[model samples]
Target: MTQPAQVPDATHRSVDVPGGRIHLVEQGTGPLVLLVHGFPESWYSWRHQLPVLAAAGFRAVAIDVRGYGRSSKPRDIEAYRMLAHVADNVGVVRALGEETAVVVGHDWGSTIAANTALLRPDVFTAVGLLSVPYAPRNGFRPTDAFAMMGGPEEFYVSYFQRPGRAEAEIERDVRGWLAGFYGVLSGDAVPPADGGDPHFVPPGGKLSDRFPDASLPSWLGEADLDVYAHEFERTGLTGALNRYRNMDRDWEDLAAWDGAPITQPSLFIGGALDASTTWLADAIKAYPTTLPGLVSSHILDGCGHWVQQERADEVNRLLTDWLRSLPGRARP
Candidate 1:
């Protein structure tokens, strides 16, 4: 695995959003591209992609969202909700003197990117999503993994809603948590041939019982691990954890739009090995089936949850290709 180019030349800027100031790092110069990071990560997650995008003749800006990194860390759980996240993106784009940008988001950031495109389609020319799909609101019902995956294949998302338990477990052992989270998707452990085992789930669930010695992929060196560890250690897990807590609220807020569709040209990129795809399989199928505007979907082979970082070459290729295909003010 080639190491990412260590370009520590990000120009920091802050924008006043509704809740607080959002910190962002802008580098390179060309057409605008907003790179958003996800849970348990900061803008550092896009270290590889930033310079590549910049070199491709695009002005790339990676943000620390609202609560992560040097950004404003709000104590209130409500402040980290979906609408607030969407507004932050809009505010950043406007503050940076751009009308529309190609929004690229991964993991939890994917959720917000989709919401931003839907809530303010005018702000984004296109969207590139990694890992998670656009979750549509369906009547504001409380749905769990058990309801979606039957009796045995439960405990994945349920682990997130366990009320201070997941955070406690992860915070107590950050390295262990990072290992478990990345290990499952890195193909270190053979998945059950017949779907997933009743006991197998990502990170803080039952899988830890079976694979006590599991470690993160060799691709993730100690430096990478330390970056994630330091951020989560400083910020604690509340900000990231609050994302799960607001699912119901998000569902309710989105419930008003019964059949809303994502009109923006959108792309779905996921690791062929990641289990998140399995969890949201139904929604993915239902999306294009219901809303025909979803342009393309790509499942990258030999990758996991951290698709962009783990498979930077393939990801950069796809992103550049997609950006080139789009009709924009500037072109390479």
Candidate 2:
């Protein structure tokens, strides 16, 4: 894998939102493209995309989503609910002096970006989803589905529901935990088919127990690990973990839009080996009705969960090409 390029002329700033401040790193100048990251990661996750998007003639800004990095972490669990995140994105665009923007996200952020476009199409003109496909809210409660997913062993999402349960496991060894988690989900160190699944925690066992013993992926370096570890180490995991704690709340909050489709122009890219893509293959197939405006869809063979990082050059070309293809873009 190619080493990440040092972003040229990157600038850092913070914007005040409803209840707290959001920290972001921005590069380039032109039509705004907001990059939102997923769990256990910060704005730095988009380090590879910043310079490329900037050079492509679009202002690329990646933010530390609320409860991660330097962003304000609300004390109440409800504060981390889905609507709060959507509100934060709206604040970000208005704060940046733009009327509308194209939003892209990965993992949990993918769901967030989809909801943002679905809820406020006027502000988010376009959307891009990486790693996870868009699945409209379903009939069943999220927790109920997750509970049934694990016949006996606790699904990782279910394990994260209780307050301080996963936090205790992660805070014990942030660096090692992060390295192990990133390793198992990455293309290079993905768990074997017969191996115990990392997504399901054995009774009384931690998720790290399933993490394979291995070196970091070629796409991730020691320095990169440090950036992630230091942030979680300083901030603690409560704010981040609270995201999982609010899944049931999100279900209740978004009941109005159940089965709704994101009608804005959209893009999707996922790793072939990623469970997010494999488990949700139906969602990808349903894109015709669910994501009718999707411009393109791709599954990068041999890649894993971290799509943009593991395959930076390929993802960059795809992103730039798709962004340039968007109708009515004044720049590029």
Candidate 3:
């Protein structure tokens, strides 16, 4: 697949992975920092962080995970599983001509990054996660999540696991889906001020309605939203939705590790206002207990689910500082 036009201060590139071409944007010239984005978003999610990292003297790279943006979109659901996702990151780092890189991930990408560091520590010098906490293998099940939230009514993730239903619902109204996802990230977009009320529902079942109403963070603008919408429009919801469908398989696969903790220095960042914080509260606190190297956790005020994009300046500052503190800098 062809790469998209390079955004100013960043240039697009593709690296051939096991499945097909992997799309990435690289900028600056120092230690390498690879930024991985999650669901319903592309590398564009890190648009704000790229320049800041680069300006701070690091070669920042943001990638479109498999099946998102211009990257290869494989039809097989297994191809999107955790092991494959980790392999893809290994391939990207190797392909970039770097032996190791400072790896960072958000949302689904956070899961992958955590697993990558655990399963393939050679490829990452350090790791950072956002939004989601590191739920160890056999940590908790989706069914457990549903029950903890007081049944299906309070959990969107459980809703994601319903085969064919979520894709059909989101695809049936793409605009509303995009808007809802967008709304949840910005503090001003939702009805209950928190995304958890059983009665809370976005227009057309859209997820963005969960967000607050202020303008999106400086990092995300109408143009960025357009870019994401266009990508979703092309791929539809099938590929993305498949991610949720594989949760059981992911859980099973991860279970083999039996609570293996991430040994590398790590950081976690999230929007204080995001409902996910409520969901993973205990897991976050217990992370350091499980992984001795887990060093910091920050919850940005006024931000929601999309913490990086919703609070770009603060996220960028924290990320740059964390990157600088890594044991060894990227040679590049």
Q: What is the C-alpha lDDT of each candidate?
A: 0.74, 0.91, 0.76
Stretches of model 1 off by over 4 angstroms after superposition: 1-6, 143-154, 188-212, 287-291, 329-332
Residue pairs in collision within model 1: none
Better of 1 and 2 by lDDT: 2
RMSD of each: 4.1, 3.0, 3.2
Candidate numbers sorted by TM-score from highest down: 2, 3, 1
Q: Write the per-residue lDDT of candidate 3 for residues 218-293, one digit (tens) a residue.
A: 5466776677877787777766767766776778887778788888899999877777777679888787676678
Per-residue C-alpha lDDT of model 1 across residues 49-74, encoded as one tens digit per residue: 88888878788998988878767878
Model 1 collision count: 0
251 Cα displacement, candidate 3 (Å): 1.8
Off by over 4 Å in 2: 1-6, 190-194, 330-332
lDDT of 3 at 160: 68
How far out, in Å, is residue 316 in model 3? 0.9
Estimate the lDDT of model 3: 0.76
Worst 10 residues of 2 by lDDT: 1-10
